[model samples]
Target: MDSFLSALKISLWVATSSTLLVALFGLALAFVLARCNFRGKNIIDAVVTIPMVLPPTVVGYYLMVLLGREGIVGAPLYQLTGWSFLFTWQGAVIAAFIVSLPLMVRVARSAIESVDEDLIRVSYSLGKSKWETFVHVILPLARSGIMAGVVLAFARGLGEFGATLMIAGNIPGRTSTLSLSIYSAFQAGDDTRAGQLAWVLTGISVFVVYLAGKLSRSRWM
Candidate 1:
């Protein structure tokens, strides 16, 4: 019971933090991609979407290269701040964020692109600043897709395993999330515990997906 609760707590913490982080930054990036056409935009878009298609282990490897102690970025940052994400809850969050970010960006970008250009033009003609127009015009119209993407990102974060395990080792009560815990339980021949956790995870996923469908339908209705 205690183990189950701890796994649940860690999963919720990592999922929630990753979801929030992805949503904020993802939406902003979506807006940029939707409205702008800078040089190498396609390359930037491709890079952002790579994790969605890449194997989890590959993504983990890339993350380790950039964030590990010997990594170029990680080496300097750790030396300067004495902070390291490896094998920590923050590492789990980073893993979740990277894997789920593409969903948020793609969905939000589609929504923003679908917004009626006429409305945007009208807003600009009214002397509204571009930022003001976006806040008042684009956001309201795209809220449903943004919300759906947020839900999807959260769900993706909750189910993350391979990348998370790479960065944050299975440390019970610290980084052993529900997905990791399930793997550990099965590996130890604790089939009963593994089954129980799997069912619980499945139920949560169903609930979130159902809630997302409702939110989407309500927005359209």
Candidate 2:
């Protein structure tokens, strides 16, 4: 019971943190991709989408290569501060963020693109700067889609398993999320515990999807 609660707590924390990041960066990238054209734009879009298609283990392996103590990015940081992401909850957050980011970007980009160009042009003709127009016009118009993306991203983060297992490992009371805990319980022949955890995950996922549908159908303004 105690372990179940702990795993639930960790899962919520990781999912919330990763979802906030996904919302922020995903909206920005979506806006940029929808509104701007430049060299290597397609390359950037493809790179962002890669995680969604690649196996989670492959994604985790790539993260390990980049963030391991002896790795290119990790080596310099480790030498300076002796800190590492390996086997930490923070590493789980990173894993969730990477796996869920593409969903946010894709949905939000489609939303932004669907906004009427005439409305944008009218905003511009009314003496609004591009930033002002985006703030006032584009965001409100795209709110439903963006909110749906956020909900999906949160659900994805909450359920992330493979990359999280590879990077964060399954250290009880530390990096073990609900998904990892479920796996551990099953491995230990604790069928009841695993069932309880699975039920909790299923309930949360259903609520998130319901909320997404509601947001997508209703307009705030």
- Candidate 1 lDDT for residue 60: 92
> CA lDDT, every prediction?
0.93, 0.93
lDDT for residue 100 in candidate 1, whole number 0-100: 95
For model 1 the TM-score comes to: 0.97
The lowest-lDDT stretch of 10 consecutive residues in candidate 1 is 212-221
Runs in model 1 lying further than 4 Å from the true structure: none
lDDT of 1 at 150: 93
Error of 2 at 91 (Å): 0.6
On a 0 to 100 scale, what is the lDDT of residue 7 in model 1?
A: 100
**Which one wins on TM-score?**
2
Candidate 2 residues lying further than 4 Å off, grouped into runs, are: none
Number of backbone-clashing residue pairs for each candidate, in the order shown: 0, 0
Clash pairs, model 1 backbone: none
